[model samples]
Every structure is written in structure tokens, then in C-alpha cells.
Target chain A: MPGALHRVLFVDLARHRSWVEDRADLYSESLGGAGVAIELLREHCPERCDPLAPENPIVLAVGPLTSLYPLASKTVAMFKSPLTGNLGESHCGGRSAMALRLAGYGAMVIMDRSPTPVYLSVDAGGVRFRDARTLWGMSSSLTAGRVMLEREGGAGHRTVLRIGPAGENLVTYAGVTVETYRHFGRLGMGAVMGSKHLKGIVIAGNGDLPVADRGAYQRTYRDLYTRAVRSPAMRKYYELGTPENLGPLSAMGALPVRNLQATGYGTEPPLEGEALAREHLGRRLACSHCPTACIHLAALREPHPEAPYFYKTTFVSYDYEPLYALGTMLGVEQPEDALRLLDVVEHLGLDAMSAGVALAWATEAFERGLLDEKALGGLRPAWGDARVYATMLECIARRAGPLYTLLGEGVDAAAAEYGGDSYALAFGGLEMPGYHTGPGAHLTHLTGARHSHLDSAGYAFDQEDMKAGQSRSPKELARALLTEEARRQVLSSLVVCFFARGLYDADTCVACLSAVEKERNWDDLMALGEDILRRKHAFKAREGFEFDALRIPARTLEVPTPLGGLSENTLREAISEVERLLASGERFSHG
Target chain B: MGKRLRVVDVERCVDCLLCAFACARRFGGGGLAKSAIAVRSVGGMERGFVVVVCRACEDPPCLAVCPVGAIRKVEVGVRVDADRCIGCSMCVEACAIGAVQWDAVERKPVICVHCGLCAQYCPHSVLAHEEV
Candidate 1:
């Protein structure tokens, strides 16, 4: 069906030209989002291509379920990662998915570098190149976005994506900020865009989507909406947001603190979620088509320096990951200190997890005499020092000095250049997300496709084991993680938020896909899941990902976790089992 | 007496776009193309959102500008007779609040019928069906 979607928009930055190609098969067979994006990456990204080269293509895709169903609010971006030098896949939610879908395209492929700074304005009218020379070198991405918003013409649904000094300087962990709060946060998508001389993107459209079965569409949409809005399971997301995980994870002693030197801070660590909500909860936000406004903003009011009776209020969006990474992981106890560091990260357009981990590593290295005052340019790297951390972040974004330049390459590369590879706290070049549940968690990081905690959510597996009062064998744990990760491919393809995993199970997925696309069944989706997983693995393998060589961060093994002492051997065994299952090519059994 | 959709509190809006979808679904189609209500960020989302919908003027400025005599006042608001509408979009420009959403495909105004489907689906209760 060559409907409103399935038209892939290819934009060449060098020539300032854009063309459309109909790839109905890609959209239909793979569905959209991750499924289609992986295919685009494999087809477009050349082997051993420098990740920041103009030849590296950036593909952005929205699933068929997007704009039609609640919680199906993500847009998947695929490119070669500058940090990992591998396939980069990141999901961002906000106005991005809705704006892209309504703009009348299933996916967009951007190739080559522009001659000069430019931001692409996309709509039904097609891509228009706008000069962004002045907008370039802005202190903050927010400034660039604000300028773009004023210059935009389309009056319909809109989303603005821009990168800051970090991306412009080609910081490997720099992220492209989406409509403010949200982002394509992981893997270095921003650096690729930056290398292309692309400043930002302004997308606006409101094209109508034709419903294949009007009756089915209404029923499915309503069912999902009601489930999302009224479900008790979803309440925590909107009320306190993901920050609520802080107290519990700390209690479990699974929370990474002081750069994984220890797990969990004391019960009343100053940056607890409840205290933040009560004190500085500014506002709540929801991505388009998402009922749960899970994005929580902290209203930080700070007195302006050298200006008496004057203040500036900044709304810094925080989640469990950033709170842990920038807050407790750095031994940052004050709300002001954590929020201040986050505020700096947001403006610099750097990935919070990567930036925080970089600082944590620097502080630990300095303390252990691996780094010194001379190496830091006469600066002290201390835990919880937001002022110094903020300065370091600035230096990293600007690539100002030798040490700052190394830190910008990500901790794995940084540690490899300096000492401290054992405590680098990175898996597959991407910084570890805030989780230290057990061996399953470490195994997830080591063996998962992107090394993202969200890839397999092995933490949840560990939590489930703890609940069961017994730890599964390494092989059993590996199989469970593999199954969960494979199943997630279908959900990510549908582009549903992982938070709604329970509500949008196999049956819900089948109904939603059937209503929007062709008639779908559980078995078809299960088959698609395995295919998607295999395709992603194939891309990683072609990019030279070696399971045998994947490092299990020694720091994780040293720390006792919620599920007790986890060992490197257990992680190695689980990794081997995961490798076996991945190679078996057997159909994942459906429920 | 008739029901009217009112913004109970604009601040309560999460900008979920659920109300807009519900408005579009009222026409048995998908997308915001058919919705008579719009929610857009006020400057950036950090500030807040403005929900644009018909205030249902007592005199009805939209009714005065319909050159084809397509629009008429209902108990709560105005409704456009699609058959007679020339799609001149005079009514679209006439509504001060810009609530008369234009159906770019059909070339007509999708004025709210005050059925309150949008209000019913608003998770935040930003909108309410009020008695008039």
C-alpha cells in the first residue's frame, strides 16, 4: 500500500537537494522505527566508515503506530556512532514522532556534509535549507532552538532538534536536543550531524493519516488511551516521574554511587526524588500522543551573580538515570549542586550519563593519583564539586585542553589513553546507565546490542530473581535476557515507550498493528522480533563488535549488589549463553 | 441548554494532544487535520501551552463572515454546513481564537459541534463540558 507514509525522504546536505523514494517493503515487512532504521543503517553505512564522516548517513524513522496510538511516541535515529565506531540507534520522544509522521514520511535519510552551516526545515512542501551561520557557536542549544522556533513558518505540529557547542566541537557523547526536555540522548547522533555542518532541524506538518479500518482504529486507540490514563501502574510516572527509583534503588544497594566505588547513599541523601518534588518540581511534560506526562522538570531559581535582587529560573528535566549519574554517583548531596550540573549538561548538549561518568572517572582518577593538578591544568577534580564539574564540562565541549579532549571521547577511550580501564564504567564505549542490580545487569551491558541498560533490561530480570528468592543459573539468566531483548525489538519497532511494556503486550501490539497496517498476528510479530534482533546483531558484527572481547567492568564485580556478590565468571558464562542463543537462529517461542 | 467545551485550566494541559486526537476521531478519521481544537507550546514548552478553541461568541463573528451562508449558530457554538461551504476560509479567519480548524484536504472549516468528545478524553481535565 503506497499510502501517505512509506515514502522515504533522502536529503543530501552537500548539494542542498532532497528526494523521496517509496520503500513500502521496508515499512511493511520490518514495520517502522528500529526495524526499518537498522535496515537503512546497514544499507547506507559503509564498512569501517569513520562515524563522523560525511559518508555516514543519519536515518530518522517513526513507526506506523506513531500518531495513531498513545505511548507510541518515539522516533528512532540510526547512524554510525562516533563514540563506539559502530551502529548507532537512539530513541527520542516529544513532538518528534508526531511531527515526522504528520510530515508525510515513514523515514528520512540525511547524507553528506553541507558546505556551510544550515538547518533543514521539513514539511509537506519538502526540505528547505536555511542559513544557520549566526546560530552556530551559540552558548547553549536552547538558544539555537529558540531562534529556529521564531524563524519557523509551518503553523501545525512542530518539533525543533538542535545541538550545542559540544556537537559543534564533535564531542562523541553530544546529544541532539529535541523540543527542549527530551533528546536522541545516546550514541553520538549529534556528532554525526555536527560533522555534516547541520545545525538543527525544524519539522512541521499536520497531514491526515487514512485509517484502514475505522472501527478497529477507534477501539484500539481508545483501549490504549484508557489503559494509559487510568492504570495505577502508570501513576508513578506522571506524579514523581522516574526519579522515584532513587529511594528504592538506594535501599536495594543497587544504586551506583561515588563512581561505583560504593552502591547506595544513606537513606536521606539530599537529592532524593520526594524532596525534589516537594521543593522544586516546576512542571510535568508529556510527549505527543502519550497520556503519561512522565517528564519532570525541576524549577531551579538561582540568584544572578553581580546582580542583586535578580534571579534566573531554569527548568532542568531529570529522570532516574541522570539523577543517579550526576547526583549520587558523583557524591553530589545538594539539590542545587546536582541540578546545576544537569543544567550545564543540558546547555552543552552532552549526554548526561556520559558527561557524569566522565566527571566521576576524572574525580576518582585524580584521587588515586592517576591524574593530578598538572594533568587537570591546575584544577582540582573533587566529588560533588558542581562548580569545577561545570567548568570541566565546558572544557570538554570546547575540546579546550588535552585531558578535556580525552574526556570528550567517552570514558572507555579516556581510560584507554590514561590508566583506570578497570573502573571506566563504560560498556561497549557507551557509558553505563544507572543500574547495578546483579550479574544480569552487567551481562546486559556486556552482551546487549547497544550495551544500553534498556537494550535487555537485565536489571528487571535480576529484580524478578530477587522477588523469586533465588538466582537463576547463568545460562537461564542469559536466555531470559535474550528473550526479553528480542521481544523488545517488536515494541521498539512499534515505537512504544518501554514504560508501557505491560500495557502494550503481544495482543495489544497485534491489534494496534492490524488496525494501522495490514492484518497482523502474534506469530508474525514474534517472527518479526527475531528478524529485527538478528538484523541489529548483523550490523554490529559487520561493524566489528566482538562478544569474546567485550569487557565486564571490574568495578561492577568488586561491588556487592542487590542479588549479592556478582562475579566476572558468571557474566562471562551468561555472555557465552547469549552468544549461543543469538547464533542458534531458532524462532523465539511465542506466548 | 447545550454543552460547551471549556478550558478548566490551561496549566493542567500536558500537551499530550489527546484532546486533539479525540476531536479528529469524532470525524472517524486519524490525524489533527480534522480537529477543531489545537494545542501549541507558548513560546517554548517550558512556559506552558495555549489551547485554542472557539469561545462561542454571543454574536458569533464566524457566522457573519460566511459568504456562502454555510454556518449557523448552535445552542453552544456555531456549526458549518459542509455542503454550502465554499472553503473560502473566511470563517477560519473570523474566529478570533482560531478555533475554526481548516480541513486542508476537504477545503472546509471543521467547526466544533460541542459534542464534547475532546473534553471526555482529556486525561488532565484541561477541558470540561460545561452547561450553558
Candidate 2:
């Protein structure tokens, strides 16, 4: 903690009271970002507390490398999720990390509910709670973000973290949008913010961070920049962003389609990255300190239904996950329709992955006669109907009816309530992401901490393993996943973007840390990563989340992947082995 | 050779602010205060961005208007002699690009030294050094 000056800012919305506390102990041991934030939540959040209640603390923390290093620009938000009913952690990149770190604070904790709508503004000097009645109840999240951006003095210096109507109305899976594009897009963090009557948080700081060795810092910074710019991985991200995955996934017949019932969309038109770039890509965007401007904005041109000469062009950003979830996953063939649906979910502040999965479930349910037209409020639930899906998204955000309310909770809960858990398309309550590549991908979803594909990168593992014709036993696969997840704790603790994994290997990470802070060595970093992973697992266990209780949806086995038929029993056995390995306290070194 | 500052093109700027960081790095400082140039979102980033810095005016109102004779033409651009400055507001108001940043801690005007160091770091062709 010699390097980290831990400052925690606590805001009480109801009384408009705010104070700062320096908790050096948290940072000294756990470091910051996800590690420290998780510890803070465990200490502050009461067990069995209502996730959206005032008692539940919403904690946001930035890692030590934030603002000082490139691609380490993510802020981790930790709170009890209204949707997941367990430990919730979401990583978002935008101005959040830089602004928070620059504002002279390591973490922000919000407690108590506000009597009326309000937003918090934190700067280098001080913090203020501004009344947001005028900006409240806005349907469009973009409008709310714009209002805060204009009203706040830090035009380019601050991040405007705001929730849309979905959050305002307490949609169970509502996410908080940051910088208008990036989001804490899972586990109902926005709903928690809304429950506290907090609409947004704007942060700006002009304070200079102290470096132990300026010369070394400068040298390393230059070296990292050169590596980042020159790396082929970085180039792919820069040119096409994440949407580049669409083409390969589709080619391999691994793109999730029709709620995991199929892997390919039977459309003649090429709905891949090349086609998207040719037809729709308008601009590219980058997160703070990221040289790879991978975020592609698609300019969707639409003619007015009535007027001949009144065409309008709107820019909607696309990534592989959003495209998969809203497009092929929902059997949406038209790219325009997919973009429209993406726009709707984004505008309403719903998690695009969860929303798409929920829609797919509803469509399947309606088709199977489990849900009828009456249940859908006379709105037909069909795959590829963009107009109806867009309207349904609105209904979901508003919680218009019983069905919408259930759908808003996410696919697992919705399917459970509607009787389709077998085809729910969820892993541990959170919906599955786009990939359906092979056993590795499915197993990763079944066992990864957040049930996110990014966790342990099972899809990447699958791709590599397939090429090599290498196979792992259940125990070996579990060990590999757990080891990778453990190592990633170090990365996430630094809060670096996972895209820079190749660049920031253990050696490089240690070098960078030593150059700046000079206290930690490689061994210490590895041990810290393992400890953090254990702590996360402990938290999950306390919340009744058992690695054994995890369910591999029947549909995963029923539908044959391009690789082979994956068995659920094998996945479950793997989970059991992982549980044993974790219990044994055995550590595996990559080298 | 006196120091000179240059901006290449406003339209070409991606607004990554690598120049700003590079300037800060050149000074061996870890903050934006050391940077000579600034980039701000114009209206919103969706619209575009504006990179602001000293254009180094020919008449140089900054030099002419300084009562304490603190402002002078340097190799990069017009710079305020930090030792000679009286923390007066005269030159700050005179500069067109609002490049004369105030160091509240030092109570002095931080005028651009126009070293073209920022231009070297601009990955995009938004900033360039030129001889007059």
C-alpha cells in the first residue's frame, strides 16, 4: 500500500451527505479494482440484504494502472445484483476509470436511498449532489447522459455514468451506460443505482499522480505503446473491432442462432464483418488509453414510412456479442432489423445479451404453445420481426405486463416461470454469450465465474485445441480453466483490458508494477491473484452458488456443435473435479 | 533557431490526446498541466473534436500586452518567462487559443513554449512543426 493512496468516497443520497475515508489496508493487501472492490462489498454489504435496498452498497473501484497506463481503463462496479441474487461485478471502459482515478479517489461507495432523483458530481476539489428532477424519467439514456454532460463543467474531463428508463423503472437486468457507448452491462447495477434514486455520477479530476520512478515509467509507457500499436492482435481490433469475430464464428457454424437451437442463420446475405463494414460501418471508437479503436459505429439509413424524401441516418455501434445476441441468436436475418433492435436495447439501458436471449426464449415459448398471443399482450412473438422486438424491448423496460416483467428478469427466470429451463440459454442465471464453438466454449460458460465467455476465454481455448487435435480430460480442462481464471485476477486487479493479455504477461506485469510502484515482485503478484480468486469463490459459496449446482442447459447437448456432441455429464464431472482442486488449495504455475 | 508550435489539421484529429501525454512525458510530469496543447470534444465527440494550442500570432498580442515583459517569442512559440511573470491576467486574456493555462499552485501563467514536441507524438496528422 506504499504506492496506493487508498481513498474511499462515501455518498449518502437521502441526506445529500458525502465524506471521504482513507482505507489503506484494503489496497495494501488486495490491491484495487475488482480485488479491493469485492473485499469492500464483502465487508460492507450485509448477507441476505435486498439487492436494491438502501442498505446495499454500490462500490466502484479503479485499479492502480488506470489513467497511468494504456488499456488499463476499466472500472469495476461491485454490488449485490437484483438479477443474479449473488455477488455481481461488472467491468466497464470509458471515462469512468480515468475520471475516478483523477478525482483523487480509489473507490466510491454509495449508501442510503435518495428522497428524490439526484446525481453525484466528483472533481479534484470536492463532491456535490445535484438534484436531477428535470432529467428524471427520461426514456432515452443518451438524453440523460447529454443533459449531465452539458450541465457539468468537465466537458471532456469527466465520465457521465447514467441509467435509462429501464433502470429508473427497476428492470431487473438494467445496466448502467458510461460514455454513451460502454456499460456495466450485466447483473442489474443500474437498478441498484436507480433504487437509491441516483440517476448518474459525473467525475473529473486534474490531480497529478505521483510515480516512484519517472524515468522508468516513461520508458515502459513508450515500450507498451509501441508493442500495442505494432501487435497483429491490436491491428485486428483497430481495423474492425470485435465485430470481426462474426465472420469466423459464422464460418465455423458456431454463431448462436435461434436461442442456441442452431448455430447458423439460413440467410443468403452475408451478415459478417466485411458486409457490415461495406454497408453500415460509419466510424471507429476507442476506449481511454487504447490505441486499438475497435468500436465500430454503424450508420443505419432508414426511409420514413410515410415521406418519400425524408430518410434519416442513425449511428449504432456494433460488436460481435451484440450482433450475435440480437441477430443470429434471435434468428434475425436482416442486418437493418438487427441494428434497430440493438439500438432499442441500448437506448433503454438493457443488457443486450440478456435481452436478446430473453426474446429468443419468448419466441420459442410462443412457438411451442407455452406462451400465446394473449400472454404477449396481442403482440406476436416471432423470430426476425424487428418492429415487434423493438416494441417488446420498450415493454420490457417499462415492465408493461407479467410476461415482460418475467422477461426483464432474464432468460433463466423467465424460462423457469414459463417452463422451458431446458432451452433457457443461460449459465448461472446470466444468459450465454454468442459463442457455441465446441466443448471448451460450452464448458467455459458452464464453469466460468460470471458465466461469461471472456472468463477463461474458453472459445479461444477451443479454437486452439481443435486445430491441434488436443483433448483434455474433465479434470485437466477444469484445472486449466481455474488456473486461467486465477491468473486473470492479477490482470483484473490491475483492471487492464483483457485484449492486452498477450502484452502484459506475468513478466511484463511485474516489470510495469516495479517500474511504477516498486513494492511488488512477480511471486507476490501471482500469490495475490490466487488469493483474489479464492476470495471470489468464497463469496460465491456464501451466496449459495456451488460449482456442483451449476446446470448445463439441455439444449447445449441436444444440438451438436461443429466440434462434436458435447456431453452434459462430462461438463458436470469437470465441475466436480474443479471443486475438488479448488478445495485442495493446489496452485499450478504456467511455466 | 527559436522554438515553434504547429497544428497540422483540425479535421484529421482523432482526439486521442497522445500529443498532450507526450508533452507531459517530455516534461517528465504525470499530468495534463505540463502539456502545451489541449483537445476538447466539439459539441460532442460524435460531431468531432477541436485541438487547441498556441498558433503563434505574428503581431503577438501576448508579448506586446505583457506589462511585466514576462512573455517572449521562443523557438517553439511564444512563452511566458515563469521567473519574470507577476501572475497578471493580461497575456492570458490576449492569447486566442486559450493556450495560456494558469498554474494555480505557482500563481503563474503557463504559456506554450512551442517546442513542437507535441507534434512528434500526434499519431494522427493533426499537429505538425513548420518554419515561418
Candidate 3:
């Protein structure tokens, strides 16, 4: 390995001290990202430690391929989630991986909570915990980002990961926003930051790396770059971005509408991707080293309510998940309304998926007379009412009322506390991602490490199986999903975007790893991936996670997917298969 | 063919820093420290980006300011004589566009040779190899 890849930076927020340590052994064995992170979490996190306590640690790791390979731009953030009260891992892309790699570290372990609100600035000069007492209560995360950007000043190469009011309030599902567009948007990473009184993290670096074999490096780099830009897999992302899935998903009757009460967007033109792009696409952006500029910014131009003949243009990012969560799930029918709601979510630095699902539950609860006007704080729960949703989003972020406080804990906790557990859409403590494809989608969310769709990409499996005109047995499907998730451990450890999985297959990943690190082969990487998966599960199990005790919302069986309503028996059988697969992972080792 | 790299579209640049990486690879390394080209956002990325590179100026300020006669005007762009140079960075200071990037490790100004290596790897075509 290059000497740089072995370095780990440790930040003690309690002591306000920062130091660097060279852990070549750990890097040599784990190869960074989730592989290294799981180990770091175990070492630093005390057994039965409070998820919000100072004893819990935050691990942000980048891989050997980071800053050396194209599209290897994701940074894996691992911590014990306060929401799930178990293993928490989230991956974000922007300049995060590159910035960390350039800032002269392979991984960073932040522990010990700050006594007061503070933000960590990491540049070539090393880590400095700056006083952020004044910046703490800023209304929106965007303003907070702007303040940090102006104060820190790395501009293009720097990544500012900051949280908003939601995080500051310790909203369980709040996320740490990356570069204003991307996020470590799952598993309550922001709440962890908030609990430490750590408001944000800033990283900037200009240094580069040394490739062992330049000839092979260049050849492989060119091949990956060419494929990333020119491939058909990336074309849709480049054109309309992830929102391109909006049309197809809606047409296929897989797009969740009105809290999964409906599965399709019925005759709604504004909710479609093509219509939104044509009407509102302002610009497109990409994470560092990624050719596909999948982050689509919609220019929402609306007339200023107070000023005549004046209009305000707000650039809001739109994607399939957020569109489904904030738009369709909340019954937001108009594009502008959905965009406005998304703008609120982004401003508050809340996880759009979790927040949307929580609100969906609230709306249903309100309509069913379980939640009255007193609980809603004068806001009525009505379908397609963006105004009501907007006010409720603020209330939840602030934990303003009895209902909002409960909802702030996420859909599972909210429903459990408030008598709507059956309708709550969360699979684990974490809420469901925007996929109503079939049994595979729900099964993946339940069985995957993070309770996220990206963990196993079960929706893709559903689409593929549908195209093949066949459905596998529950056990067979479990094997396929688990295989993909296991292989993805390599990708996440290398910290590459999941979108580029086709380009960075196991062999290609091994080739890339060999160029950057020493004493590693394809077999070692495969074993390391399996070991990482086991370690993550071990962490979860240690923290009281139970596979058999996993909850599949009753509503999941009620909603008719594209393949019709999923059978409970099949979903339960899939979970059983997952348990057997995980038992094998326990025996796997990194050696 | 004497091809010079040009910032064809600043708006199209995603600030990926691939061009910078490509330039550094010419010296058998990875990083922006030795690269002559620099891509930075104008305050914030949502606004846009600014791609800083040598314009291959007529009667360049860098060549004029070199006290030891280390820099010479080449066919398309200026080249630095590392042997003759005292690393004064007068030439770097002379350039108004801030295209004269300083190598922190070597303590010398790294100027663009207009080799057009950066243009080839530009995925978005933000940079172009213009044939003069």
C-alpha cells in the first residue's frame, strides 16, 4: 500500500484534540470503507454503549481505490444508529471520498462528544474543532453550508457535511447532507452527530497518490472512465438522472402513491420525470470522479408572494426516492408542490424517505381519527395538501408537539406509541425506501444490513425476474439477494457508487485494489467482503437485533405491487433463508 | 500537431478534477499538486465552476518575469527550465489568471505545457484540445 492509505485520523470532541495514527495492518487487512469501518466501530464503540452517548464512535472510511479510480467517490460512515438502536452505516458521495483521501487519511474515527456545538474543519493543516455556537440554530442547512463554505473556503474540492434543525433537535432519522445535494441519508447518522453536539464536518485536500504500476493503472483507469461515460447504463442518469425512473416506475405500477395505499400515480402529469425535466431542469451535477452527473437540480421558479412581478428561483434536487417519499407518498400531486416540500426537507436536513413515511402515517392516522387537530397542531391531514405537509415537516424537525415529537422518532416508534403500528411502513426501525415493486423489494429492505433498498437492490432483481418471466422460490430469491449484497460489500469497502456496480465487478475491483494496495488478491477481497458482512451483522446482533423478530408492516401485504400483493408466507420464508445465509457469514474470516 | 488545451465550457464542468489528475499522470503520479490546471467553484457549486489554465498568451507575462531566464516561449505554450530556475515564483506571481500552479513538494511553479493530455480524459468535454 501507498504510505498514505495507512493513515487514520482520530478526533476527540470531548478533549478538543486531534491526532493521526498509521494503521497499515488494518488497511492491509480490511482495504478500507465498510471493511475497515466495521472493525473501527468495534474497537472504539463500547459494548452496550448508548447510541447517543460520547462512548459511541463515528467512523468515516474511504477505500484504496478512492481518489485513484473513476466513480470510486463514496465514503462509508458507520456508527450505532439511535433510531434502529443497532448497526448504523450510510454511504455518501460528493467530494467526500476524494476530500478525505486527499486530506491525507484512509479513514477517520471521531469519538468523544463535544461539550458545546462545534464543527470540525479538516484541511492539509490537520483537524481543527472550530466553535459553532452561533451557527447552531440556523434556520436551514443551506444557510449553514453557505456560512461554512465562506468561513472554510475550499470551494470546489471541499466537501461540507452539515446537518440542519432536524439534526440539532436530534430527530432520529435526520441525515448529514453532503455538498447540499447528496447525503449519508439513512440510519440516523445526523442524530449521532447532533448527540455529540458536532454540527458539521468540512474536508478539503489537493495532494495526490502514487500508482504502483502506472501502465496498468492508466489502462484500467481509461477503461473504467470510458465505460462510465459511454455506457448505456449511465445514459439515463446523464440525461434525466434518477428521476428518469419516475416515469418507468409509475408506468409499471411500482411507484408508491399515497403512503402505499395506491401503487401507481393515477393520471398525474406533474409527478412524471420527463414533464418535470422539461419544465424545471436547471442544471445537473456529479460527485467527484463520477462521470455520470446524476444529481439533477430543478429550478423551481415561483412568483414572490409579497412582491408583485417578482419571482424567486430555488434550485431543488429531484430523484426517484425523494419524489416518491415527499411527492407521491405524501399525496403531493403537483411538481411545484413536491419540489416545495423537498425544499423544506433539504433545508431541515431530514431524511426525505423517513420523514415522508412518517408524515404518510400521520396523515392516515389523522384521517382515521386516531390523531386529532390537537396532535396535528392545527394542521389537517389531507391528500395532495402540500401546505399541511410543509408545516408538519417543521413541527417534526423542532419536535414541536406531542404528535410531531413521536413522529420525529420515525414511523415505527411513532406508530408503536400512537396505535397505528399495522399501517406504519418501516421494515426495521428505519423506514422503507421508495420501492413497491414486489416481494423482493420488501424482503431486501427487511433483510439488508441497513434496511435500505440499495443494500441488495432487490428492485432490480424484481425487474429482471419479471423480464425473464419467472419467479424463484423464496430460498432461491434469498440466495440471489444475499449474493448481491455480499458482493456489494466489496464495492462499499472500495467506497464506489452502487450505480457503477456493472463497471466495477469483482475482477475489476480486484484489479483496481492490486494497483493501489499491496499483498491483496481476488480471493482475499472476496473473503474480506464476507467477513465485513458478518462483522456488521455481529454488531447488530450484539446491539440486540434479531432476525426472527424483524417486523414486516401489515400494510406491506395489503398493497398490491406490480406483481400483485406480496404473500406473507414467501416473505417470512425469505427471512428464514437470510438467517441461514448469515450463519455462514459468521464462520467467514478476513484472512 | 501542436494542440493546446482550452476550457471550452466552464458551465459544463462538474469540478471532477479529472483533467488535473490527467495532467499529474503525465509525471507518473496522482494529484493536483503538480498539475498546471485548477478547477474551483465560484463560491458555491450551485453557481458554477472556474477552470484556470494557461491561455497560451502572446508575449506572456510568465516568460517576461523569469529573472534567471528559466522560462522560454514554446511553440504553443511556455515551458519551465527546472535546472536553471531558482524557484523564485516571480513568473507564478506575474500570471493574472492564477494558472501558474505551484508544486508544494518541489517548491517550483508548474506551468501548463499545452500537451492536451487533460482534454482526452475530460468526460463532459468541458476542456478541449484546440488545433492552432
DockQ values, each candidate: 0.83, 0.48, 0.68
Off by over 4 Å in 1: A1-3, A589-591
lDDT of each: 0.88, 0.80, 0.86
DockQ class, candidate 2? acceptable
Clashing pairs for model 2 are B2-B75, B3-B74, B3-B75, B3-B76, B4-B75, B4-B76, B76-B114
RMSD of 2: 2.2
DockQ of 1: 0.83
lDDT measured at residue A84 in model 3 versus the true structure, 0 to 100: 93
Report i-RMS for every model: 0.9, 2.1, 1.4
Runs of candidate 3 with Cα error greater than 4 angstroms are A1-3, A154-156, A266-269, A585-591
Q: Write the per-residue lDDT of candidate 3 for residues A400-437, one digit (tens) a residue.
A: 97789889998888887788888899987889888888
Ranking by DockQ: 1, 3, 2
Q: Which prediction has more favorable TM-score, 2 or 3?
A: 3
lDDT of 1 by residue, A1-591 (tens): 322668899999999999899998898889888999999989988888899989999999988888888888999999999998886889999999999888888899999999999999998778999999999899999989989988995577899999999999999989999999999989998888899999999998787888788899999988888888889889889888988888888888888998998888657555778999999999999999888999999999999999999999999998888888888889887888899988888899999999999989999999999998987878898888888888998999999788999999999888988889889999988898889998878888887788899988988888888899898899888888888888889998988988888899888998988887788888888788888988888888898888888877788888899898877787888888888878889764433
TM-score of chain A of each: 0.98, 0.97, 0.97
